[model samples]
Target: MADRLRVIQWATGNIGTRALRAVIEHPRLELAGVWVSNPDKAGLDAGALCGAEPTGIRATGSVDEACAIPADCVLYMRQGTDIDEVCRLLASGKNVVTTRGDFHHPAGMDPALRQRIEEACLAGGTSIYSTGSSPGFVTEALAIPLVSLSRRLDCLTIDEFGDCSSRNSPDLLFNVMGFGQPIGDFDQRQADHVKADFAASLSQLADGLGLVIDCWQAHGEYAAARTAAPIAAGTIAAGTMAAQRITIEGLAAGTPRLRFRANWYVSRDIDHPDWDLRESGWRIRVTGDTPLDVGITFPVAPEHYAAFTPGLTAHRAVNAVAAVCAAPPGIRTTVDLPQVLAHLPAQSSAHSSENLPT
Candidate 1:
């Protein structure tokens, strides 16, 4: 048919592995290379790392090695906030679509870091876009469409609830999220980061609605585990913090108008028994003249829910590759891009040689 866009799958972690699979399966994308940060994963076949059969493309630990490969886009799924590496990728002339939570808005980002990314985009004529399950899909992609139905919208609220017991990443669960820590010892820095990240998402939504936010605030609460329970991360001791609820609000004029709320529980039986419990999902409530409430239920097994979140995150980035490549060189967001849908390729028994590494 037509020439497919060449894509590099960077960092084969939870989200990266899913992005690799999506890139391989899409009809309009070619798997150019795979980049991994772990030294042990270097030189391994992309297929092996992603739980599929060997596909010839090997993972490299060095970003320079991956950047040297000819590619139209890079699906960057690395965890943690690293803006410098993102700028470097854009400077290499490869368009980027990432699941990183930090790049939602330019105003919320560090000014110098934002300037560097803009300079790189201008120099190489490439664009970079970032998204994730919560900040990207639920808040913007899903909420924006629902809000469009309103004739007179006053305020918008988005809530995400997930049971994260099945997630195996210790660093993400206990360390980053403060899952097993005492309520008193919970890390304020992580909470501040969450506030900033979600605030950026809220600001993006405000911009989409043509509303200017005058003030922003963040609130957090923790619920201790009632009893010891086994989680993929580790054993939770009784009375340790097992649930966290965070709300970030943006005010227009003098009212609390926009709200982004997240509720995470390591186990379902945590202190807030009244809290809505489901396999996993998000709810959006738009309040005004015509109040609208929408609930998206992801009815997967609890064990599979952990994988489902990252899989959706990766898919969002992968689906946006073409739009980013075609756009003018700059930082783009969901509000700026056209409707990007999943282009699933037809199933084939024989592997396509076109997807093989050069």
Candidate 2:
């Protein structure tokens, strides 16, 4: 173990770029290698992909080559990739910190995956942890504080309403929500018990709150422009709108009442952005016994995006770096490791930590 932990960054997208920059800035982590899917990216300088100084690490799509590097951990930001590959890497006795959807579900996730990682950790004597903004930081960091106010657990709720015009890339917009499809067709495709990212996050929330879901249901809503609204590259589906909301109950089957809601909405002017200014992000509300009720809203700021998203992510990455560098390796969530709650500064007065349970 050295003073600075070595890190291999997977993916080269927006979040990946952010994570890469973060690892560069962190005093305790070094960028060991870059993993990419494009053949052209292979053999290229990792720093070049991110417009940073050369670290001499080459970008390659070979997982084995990347894993073979003498590094302590992998800081993963790759999306739509299988957890099995990540699990294999972790099982090889390398620590993994990923933003993948499935790994954050809960402690008992896939029995095989859990067993493999545990075995590796026990054998290698290392640690692994996974986290992100929505499921990672918001669900755990934010929810843990609310726990203090409740004597008995009841339910929890989180809502993220944002304008992704500036943040989201083209591939993400169409692929995730079927954005380009006709509303009729898109609605029909998503009508059934189709699981999504929000479901996984809800599961994480339940796990964080120590609740076992008896049953869960997810819903979606869409509204096209009542009238045409201008957007990048000409009109986009004439006021295209897509939203998904899911609720998972902790109560047993046939229980009287069980309530929870996790929602994601992307629309052009859903709230009429303060055109005079810029405002975006979420309003999070949590409730439990002991009159626990508080709503938090962080308006989007152009300046904050650069630092806020990755800074919060870096905090989680740094927290996971130790585990990823140590013996036990496999996909693990924040709940699996020591809590990162203590590391964050107390929220300002507008957000109180007064009633939290000891």
lDDT of candidate 2 over 203-234, digit per residue (tens) = 66566666677665544555454445444323
Q: TM-score of the candidate numbered 2?
A: 0.73
RMSD of 2: 7.4
- Say which candidate scores most in lDDT: 1
Write down the RMSD of candidate 1 (Cα, Å): 4.8
Task: Report the lDDT of model 1 for residue 268.
Answer: 71
| Consecutive 10-residue window with the lowest summed lDDT within model 1 | 349-358
The list of candidate 1 runs beyond 4 A from truth reads 81-84, 165-187, 224-242, 266-279, 348-358
Which ranges of candidate 2 are over 4 A from the true structure? 82-84, 106-108, 164-201, 204-210, 224-228, 232-279, 291-315, 323-331, 341-358
Alpha-carbon lDDT, every model: 0.82, 0.57
Question: After best superposition, candidate 2 residue 352: deviation in angstroms?
Answer: 30
lDDT tens string, model 1, 107-143? 6788888899999999889998878777888878887
